[model samples]
Target: MTPPSRPKLSLRASLFGRFSLADTGHDLRPLPQQPKGPISMVMRLGAMGVLLGRTTRLVFSARTDKGDTLRLAHKFANGSAVFIVVAMSFVGMIMVYQSTVQLNRAVGDTQLVGAAFLKLLVRVLGPTVIGMLIACRIGAGIAAEIAAMAVTDQLDALRLCAADPIEVLMVPRLRAGIIAALSLVIIGSCASALAGMTTGVVLFSMSPSTFWNFELIDNADLVQGIAKAFVYGVTVPIVAGAVGLSARGGAAGVGRATTDAVVGCSFAIVVLDSLISLMSHVVAGL
Candidate 1:
């Protein structure tokens, strides 16, 4: 019996055939499943600390894509600025109103309201609020993008191409995050101050001069706020990247990673805030 003749391959297929499995052969190993116990949780936390240390080193070494870092910084600032401004404006107004009302009821003296509020905003409220917002906005994005790459083995492909994923993927984000955090904190703090002043003038019948007082704040408060913003900025990307790099399964895993990233970022922000605040207090006392 005569065998059937084979069909000729198309020129397009012939041209592309050699690279058809270009995405294959790389390690696609998924990380271990999510921790289910105290010990596992502790281990995961330790791993995240190690990852953070490595990323911080790369950032300090200046091993990053400058264009990418600038682009991401712009995106983080522009995308989040409006949200931060609006939310913080409302928060400022509400805080001023409530505190003024309470103080007025108690002592009929709201003269120091602006100064106290500004002090709190500069030291605690502004940075913490901004950090939480960034954690929700940027942390999820970083985790989702990197987790998708991780599950698809693109990270491995980068490794095969002699690219360090930490240097390429994580360092730019860490740098950008710092810039965004500092810029947004400044912008958001101004918005909150303006809003608080407006509330005082309109609702409380207080003069703008009185409500815009800066008497209660000092260099220490400004330094604390900036320090918090800087730390929070560095933390969000590192935690998100760690969560992302450990992603497994598939799309569901990516979603899980994003959730974990936000949660981790928020928890880190709160914990760091307490520790830093404590340290600052101790230093001031000394």
Candidate 2:
């Protein structure tokens, strides 16, 4: 096959004296069109949905390779744990102080402080706080790495080697994400509970056993927190992966994808937590 010609342009070589601008008369190649506003947002959301479905399907497929899964899981877990622990501990302290102040005003007893702190950590803080942490910590990294691979054509090379990108990349990340998120949630829950307990014991002058003695944590709290973790774990990878996979324009695009992934995952965690929490309440009632 032959190639198409660059349409020839014949133009005056002078504006004042030998001044010509970009060959002066040739029509410029059309610039790439960008999707605008609502359309662009909808397209991105649609792409994310598609990738979620595709990755979910790939997750169900049997595989012989466990090395990637295990390695990534360990890597993500180690990277995220310290930050989560520290953050949760601080969060726990603040909650304890605030809850103590409020409850002491109302009940005039520091004993009720433990009950409020326990409920706050188990019901809300454990999942939402951990989810946001993972978004900033892991989600951004995944998006950047995948975007770099896409820009450098490594994804193409993977396909050339007959590897399915979803199986090799997406599925492993999905597994690692869920495992790491769940682990972090458990650790965070403990850190928060311990903080609340310590603060109650020291500042509020409550007994240590008071912390766990309260019936603050019901079965719904446990179930909802776990569900939020799973939802967050699943959401982070899907949003990051889809944005990374679709990245264009080299370094700039990679940066954009990472930013998008972080923002999207954070927003997703909040929305999912709220919706699921409400849904769980409705379901429990029925």
Candidate 3:
């Protein structure tokens, strides 16, 4: 029998198959065209509005979510900080008294040290009150807001909607944090000054008028403290929000996020404070 004729391969068919293959060397399909309509524009605006609304809602909710945890933390931190301040102030008062007592004795100026003590007390108390108020108001708010958003799936929704979540979520928090930090620092500084001055007068017998007159606080020192507080403020909220957004597992996740926020913020504050101190010294030397 004659050998069966080999099935002829159609060149055109082979070429077509090659071209149509999913792993083809080249894809010939045209790129999709952009939408060109008022409706598209409106949709884009709507998405933007949603992002804005969510961010605003979170911020507003943060203010309302102030809780006992925050209050307790504030009281604890403030009391501890105040105690430390008092101890340091006492040391400073002793030094000031030692330094000025001889001058007073020599000049018959018994009120000099008393005035200085009063001023120091005022400074300390002012800053302490301010710090406590801020820690309670802003710290707790951040923790609650971030934890709530995480639990609500708002962050995931933002990702699905192709939104730049960082800009939408973090920017506002950063702005708020800076403002809160500055306000707190100012208040804290005032409290510390007042407390120090008071302690000086009551315990050390320093002169109030002379203490106020002495320019012990430099502009640079004040600026450094404010800058440190502002840095802390910005970092704390962002970190808390990030932690909350990334939380997994349900109520447990929220708890983790809140705990992380508080611990992380506190740690960051300490680190930033050290760096600021170094920078301040360098700048002052210059």
List per-prediction Cα lDDT, in the order shown.
Answer: 0.83, 0.78, 0.50
State each model's C-alpha RMSD to the native: 10.5, 10.2, 17.1
- Show where candidate 1 strays beyond 4 Å: 1-35
Candidate 1 residue pairs in clash (backbone atoms < 3 Å) = none
What ranges in model 3 sit over 4 Å off? 1-137, 159-163, 283-286
> Alpha carbon lDDT of residue 44, candidate 3?
30
The residue-by-residue lDDT of candidate 1 on 1-286, one tens digit each, is: 9997654543222222221112233323232343358855675576567667667777767555589999999999999999999999999999999999999999999999999999999999999999999999989899999989987988879878877887898889999999999999999989998999999999989998888789888899999999999999999998898888777679998999999999999999999999999999898851
Which TM-score value belongs to model 2?
Answer: 0.85
How far does residue 221 in candidate 3 sit from its true spot (Å)?
1.6
Candidate that scores best on lDDT: 1
Q: After superposition, how far is residue 258 of candidate 1 from its true place, in Å?
A: 0.8
TM-score of each: 0.87, 0.85, 0.52
Tens digits of lDDT, candidate 2, 151-237: 787876876687777778889999889998899899988988898788888887778877676587778787888888888889998
lDDT of 2 at 132: 95
